[model samples]
Target: MDIGVALRDLGQVDSTALIERVLGFDEQAWVENSYRQKQYDVHTLTESVVMIFTDGKGWPNIEVSKESGWDLLADVAMPLMHKIIERHYPPGGTIIRAMAAKLLVGGVIKPHVDAHPSFHVGHRIHIPITTNSRVRFMIDGKPNRLAVGNAYEINNQKQHSVMNKGKEDRITFIFDYVPPEQLQRMQQMQQASQ
Candidate 1:
């Protein structure tokens, strides 16, 4: 997902509905899918309501499926996601992961690259639903502030992290998208292996 840059500002969008929807979820929803936090030590202070996720136990060929959050957020999230995609990405890409991730007040997502094979190719897009001035998103040792209503594509291959020193929790809707060309290449590779 390294677009040869630290951050690519994909401009702004109307996230009012998405924001309202995310705020409606109960506290229990955030903890329902603890996979990200459990697997990555850096995300221990974070909680997520994962909508679509991939089954990539063996790597390369992955299976994507809808999780619990899909029921809660898809109606509002999908339209926004699609709008972003239509404007910024190629048609017919697959979203391997989609979720509303929260960094609790005073939490820090220690700096690290997204090392998974999927992350190497997919675009890691983020839309901040709620953020405070104190939240700093650092990429490669530099601090960048991501605000609400704006979308960004981050280079997940490089070291990146976030720290929420604000009084309110920082929430962002993130998704990993594999453009059609990249997806076709992966499919061919998988078939060749078989």
Candidate 2:
């Protein structure tokens, strides 16, 4: 579905500062081990953090990569996230299931579709920081470079992939957005017609 005409600008937060804090993170805490697929070009990096959020019903995964430790949803990052949620998914709406944050050292996620459940509700959004121009968002068989201060909405239900061709590690804050009621209604109608 196309983005609504009345798109909202989630307040801008200090992207650099937030990333700095994330890099300073300490990984002493023992969390569940993460799953890494061999399909994506994997490599070791300075440090990275993967955080997952579930809205109960749908899958809403958000991965925030930093130069080091992961610092996401800081006071600065909150506003933008809230605005995104408000603009795309209504309050208390959607069933967010999982989120992941991966740090790529010039790594690439081979072109592929996300898990089936992920395609049903939310679309993935990426925020590039500390990343070089080599990083690209391949959506619908087209490559789109993510601009640092700009937000782009992606239909994960469609085909897409991530690539970081630069030498520097690319950190993208990725998350999912669910369609609001009106959009959902239209989706149902379209499906019924088909």
Residue 16 alpha-carbon offset, candidate 1, angstroms: 0.5
Task: Write one digit per residue (lDDT tens) for candidate 2, span 1-194.
Answer: 23332122343444665465444544541123333332224322322344444322321222223311123444445455566666655675442322224456566666665554544555556555566777776767877665666555666555666676777666656565555764466457657766
User: What ranges in model 1 sit over 4 Å off?
Assistant: none
User: What do the candidate models score in CA lDDT, each in turn?
Assistant: 0.92, 0.50
Candidate 2 — worst ten consecutive residues by lDDT sum?
Answer: 59-68
Please state the error at residue 150 of candidate 2 in Å: 2.1
TM-score of candidate 2 against the unseen true structure? 0.61
Clashing pairs in 1: none
Q: Residue 14 deviation, candidate 2, in Å?
A: 4.9
